[model samples]
Target chain A: MSAFDIYIKSINDVLEELKNSGRRINVFNVPSSCSELPRTIPVNIGGNANPGIILRQDTYVELGNPEAGSSAIMISTNETGLINDGRITLIGPDIPESADKSLPFGQVILIGGASLDDKEHETLQQPGFVGDKIEGYMIRSLPQNIWSRISKDGAAKGFNFECLGKALIYLYKSENPKIESMEIIFITSAKDDVKLLDNISEQVRKISKEITKENWKIKGYDIDCELDCSSCGDKSVCDDIRDVLKSRKKKGLVK
Target chain B: MINIYSQLMSAANKSLFGLTLGPQNESDGPFIMGNGDFFIEIPVAFGCSFSDLTLTGAMGTGLPNAAELIDKGTEVGVESRLCNAIKVATYYLEAGLLKTPDMIITTNSCCDAMDTLGNLLNGYKPWAHIPRFNMHAPHSYDDASYEYMGKQLRQAVKFMEDVTGRKMDMDRLREVCIESNKQCQLLLEFQELKKAKPCPAEPDLAREGAEFKNWSKDRISPQVTEWLEILVKETEKQVKEKKGIEGVDEKIRFLWQDLAGSWASGTVLARLQKELGAVCVMDYVSFGTWTPVDLSSEEAMFTSFGKRFLLEDPMNRQALHTTDLFCNDILQIVKDFSCDAVILPAHIAHRDTNSRIKVVRDMCHEKGIPCLVLGIDIWDKRYMTPDVAFDRMKTFFEISGLL
Candidate 1:
């Protein structure tokens, strides 16, 4: 009946649809205490005492901006346990500390579920949908990148990474029943620390894309080809043969 | 023991071949290069060699490894979301495989990828020594936009001259413009021949395929003019002889949008032709015109060049303007070429054009023209293998009752 409930329901429907379309779905369950966890956190941009979602104008800059280090990484792992369900870790300095400074940013989301499979690779990578679903969170660039903004109103209501991480866990748990545990990690402290995680994150992104491309291949789409047609000399002969085969098919003789 | 004259000629031929392939080294002199989507009219007119970095990377002509270059670019911090073509160009430059241009010229005609790549190139070590000229195309096509583009054209010429130490010879520019206009006329005539019932140009798939493969190399040379003339003559003979592609029954005619996956091994066009009796008689890359320039005077030539680049280059036009053009062109081309359907190759790199697919699809639907959007990456065949593309086309043709 509530807006938040409706949003949760819509996300469930999307996950259900993906499942019905032969994509494996994964959902993890967390302790009921996770939902009741306090939303107040000190992730505000200027160390402000605002609640809910804090608009951190100084916390992070656009990746491509000269001020920003232009480093980004996204990591997802299935190595999880039941106790770690809905657990989020912030390894680096909070937003207030890095305000007005360009620093490396990293995000890691770990999920554990009973039914998770290679087919559900994209399903787990659906955290990008959170930026759109959250009423006041405005992600400036692609969610996979660190360029994001929060509405002043949301920040005043005490918005922080804890709130976002909790919301993600709630959504995933509510949407799919298969997930048994989920954890979100944020690293924005120092460039050296972020760099190590970023290297892994980059590898994860590559593997995820390869998985998606493989899925397309299974569904009958060739994401790429292996032939070097640019240098081929017998192209005309091949074209002639193909033409003849096509003609026979058109005449209903080859089919 | 070769004669000195013979040795000199051989060396010259080798150098010319390297230039045709792409800028081989910094010593190749002040070359002007940019995205292939924009017109290189001014650069060509300035007597400077023009290289389309996107096409060079796509064809893997001079690069040590196109895929590796793309990876290097991503590792160096270019956004992975950027199109592979732009990434490949950036990688090639960063890896020292591509010779840095004396000056980089580009227009905000297509997408943000160009801007990102241009910025990265500007910061790259090789390009830091040179200047990068960025031209902003107006959103609306009018007299004002034409004038603005004309000013940019003149500025670009000056920049080229400044970098190359060459004077802008009005007489030489006019001569090149005349030849370019002649080439455009020949191209238009060739397009007209596609309206024939059997389609005169359908049989020359091999030649067209080769041209698409070596698109970058062939563009600036007189060889393009010769090829166009040969195509015109061949099409004329086909019209006289009433010949189409040898085995094709020509049961269906389709208009291919932008670049098709013709670079792929089996090719989307070849698949459609063979399995469903569909002939892609016209495609955006080959059929689109770069409106003829007037060679009467210096001002007239520059104005014509500006108008062509601003109003005629499809990638440079506004989104709404481009959609309208697509609708109008598809409608007329369908009737003119007797096309039964439209095949819009949704090239992943061309995000700007991909956004207009729904509009084109709806227009075709209203007109009772069946349109199929094939998800393909034109430059990279790995994005859509020939078998996969063929299966999709076969299904679409079967549903449309063209098979």
Candidate 2:
């Protein structure tokens, strides 16, 4: 078999093992034709991802070469309205019906950066959303408990960054994923100025390279978004990216 | 009708009394204040805007000063006392205790603390807080922004009168000013006593003078002034005689990372000087002493006495930015004083420590001087005791030796 086939088979075997052990995993690709649909995956689904396989029981698998658990993988997706709540959308592969009945079906809510305004946050608290939809991929091969243990333990060893990078590659290397361009959006309440947007684009591009190791490139810069200046109009000022607007505008980024 | 001041005073007084009385005492009348022969303690609820804006403004506008506190320095004193005083004054005024004056006069010595306070008070009392400004140092001072501060104070006073039913009584206020100035002069005399070359009085005494002299100015007496005079004279005489702990490597000057003292911490620094052979010659307070105070009129004793009121209360730009410009100034002072080492004994475990460390690191790097940084609450021993942290400090000095 070719290298791509081997990678796909390896992931499928892990899903099978997870089903035998009694847990669930779901995974899906954004359909080629439905690119415009923002992901509507419900958060706090108790499982990592949806539309994927179910693990028959709890299981743990070591990731990365050093035989350390800290090098495990973590996957995240963009969930609709969860941006405010800070819960990214994720889903696992298909699961057996018997395994789903035995184990609780839920998304694993992240501890940090979750916002109350997000749908996942509401679902996690209330366990209900009017029209919940699940999308994206998941891995049942790794147990639910392993996500944090791997991240924290790896962080202690300075391998956390490396592990996270590797996890993203491992999850998306297969399934023939198409390239999606990352767009940097600059929104400000100040007068509409293209130069301001350019400065924001530069900053976003700079930070994007630092965090994603250039794997995520800025596709383009776009204007037409205007965020209300919390501080400019006798309101309490917020200390965020918007704070840099006045400085950046003077540098000729905003016109 | 029982006003908010009465209600708040009762609640706050109960809380304070409960704290002071310990656990066993019965809760009594939480009277905010009582009438005295010459004065009255009218309790009032201070608006939250002062703390919210001033603290935030200091943190933001004062970022430039972070380079200073992390550097080495000699003399240091905490001025949260001044900040607290302003806070109390604001609370009292908001609660209708202190009547809004026709003129809100102040000197220029305070940092962002006063500016923010003046603005916040004016915002709260629009009509009563009108403008009648005073410049602490009309000329020969840096930070020209201070020139406009008097205008802000005047505005605050006018706005205050508009809010409260009190009219400005110029004659009565002039009398109050005279009394207050005399009291402040007496307090200054006591403070001067702490400046003996060898410091005849204990460091703790000097610290108490620093902390409470302005606070208890309203309760001044002949006895208090006399006692202060005697103390100052005695301290001077003792310093001439070299009565205090003397003699260390003259080069062994230490810059405090911040003022590491409660009432108790001052005593500890004094002990460190004696035991560790180091002198603390400059600090945030040294810069603070240069702040302009009220100079409204000669007989405006209230102007003199209330100078502390006009000065930044509880907090000052210098106090907040000890880690900012003061750290760098301190390092230069250390070099000028020919100091040996720098030590930062901040409560590093506290939530505010990361910012403190960042400032300190900037100073150390700028001067290329080694620093001994440790974390421990100077007042409380429960968090991380000084003893446990002292060895780490010693180890740093061991590595770097004397600067």
Candidate 3:
């Protein structure tokens, strides 16, 4: 299976179990700044994408209108999470089978990040971003909050899940992925979460050995974790601790 | 003056023909008439010395009013006041307003002014070009920039030589520099004159020093040299006797920021200095000239570029960094000089970056020094003329009681 397709399958399995358990859940898809990486110039171009706005892109319509039997789940993406097309996709499932396909939805709202241009003389003269909001297919902005959050607890806090959630949103906004009574999955890039997948896989092994529940059975799969800092495989900013360690060793402070 | 006119009338003066001079007032007229081609308007720099004549081309039509010009165009528009100045110079040039100097040399101290003038001259004829040199604002004095500017001065000398068909004569240059130093010293003295309870010199003299750039002219020895020396002696005597100049008013002191005179209310600042009893003790241009110590290099071209470009780097860095070092230096000057307040007139184009304002305001605020931030343009006076701007400033000052 393709990499993103495998990701989709694994995440669906987790979501399916969560849905059957009757807990309300949300998934946001986001893109990594990798694709927009500049050919020249030392400055990173990816920070321009605001994370909060990306999470809210397709969820704007869902936030506006409410339905009787429909549960709302927002899928967001960032960095590696974006689809081939620039459009960020969102997928919402209707509670009833018939209402799923035919539900009328509001317009897809796209959220861009904070822009440097917005910090213009007049804009800076005011309190915030000059109340000059952007609503379009492709937008630009600085995700200040997201950068802070990622900086603090990025690797340990299941950030891969959040990153994948953002990507899922991107896919849905593009392909408009449909979810029915089938199982849901949660694919992630965290090593610890991948170990949790081992637990799920072990549980699936036991369930397969004996007779299990009737409705939602999670046939387990482990989350794949690939860490490549040089090429940027994930959306979080990894501390270049290796450099600090190497410097220490070189200085004879550490082995 | 009439004898010189009569003498010129007898001889065939061929210099005024091909120049298209213009837009200068009638009182400053006929100085640049010749037998060249077409004399468009008035020759504003006719009797001025050669180097002074060089900047005469700089005299262009001031925009009618800021509001009318801005109203006619979009938000981001290039107002061509500088272009009109160059064209005026060109009109006189073609009409032989000058003795027909071969090349044009332009300096960029007035931001868009010289840039526009240079481009207009180049566009008029491909060969007719002014090599662009930038003047550092007097206040910005970093060591590295000073060194760079020294090199730029050397290079500017070469440029001037090429344009004026004259070699860089060190003796002549030293003479010019000494003469120019006298003017700068006079200005410094004038600045010091403000210490008097009622200043001895008119505050408007400072404005004339800032705007007209009389120091930049050649032949500085004759008129200004003699006049300023005598004035300095007279003003010193008057000050010793505790006497004030007649027709002069007392003024307070303030810091000025983001006051580039274009498409904005320069009149506001002019008026504030007048009616509000406030003298701009610290300004971007006044503080920007922090010259370098080590500019002696063998390669004249590189040294010249380094000098001019580095000095100009502060203005260039305006887009990136929030607070300009030049502004910071002015703030330091404010603290040291015991100025009352810093008045910042940030207009639409310059308001986006809050670096300079942020630093100055925060520093001044923390120090408990009164700093006023005014949002207005320094050049375009469409919405308000000098009188109206002065009136508003007077009201503001009276209400604040800083006067």
Candidate 1 per-residue lDDT over residues B60-129, each given as its tens digit: 5224464565666668677767777677777767778765566777666556777676666556765676
User: Against the unseen true structure, what C-alpha lDDT does each candidate score?
Assistant: 0.56, 0.32, 0.35
**What is the C-alpha lDDT profile of model 2 across B234-302, one tens digit per residue?**
555555465543344332455564544332243445445566655564433322221123335523222
Model 1 local distance difference test score: 0.56
- Candidate order by decreasing TM-score: 1, 3, 2
Candidate 3 interface RMSD after superposing interface residues: 26.3
**lDDT, candidate 2, residue B57?**
20
Off by over 4 Å in 2: A1-255, B1-144, B159-164, B168-199, B217-227, B245-253, B261-314, B319-324, B328-339, B348-370, B394-403
- Give the proportion of true interface contacts each model preserves, from 0 to 1: 0.00, 0.00, 0.00
TM-score, B chain alone, candidates in order: 0.84, 0.51, 0.59
lDDT of 3 by residue, B233-290 (tens): 5556655566643533545666565434443224554455455556555454433221
lDDT of 1 at B10: 42
The candidate scoring highest on TM-score is: 1
The CAPRI category of model 2 is: incorrect
RMSD of 1: 24.0
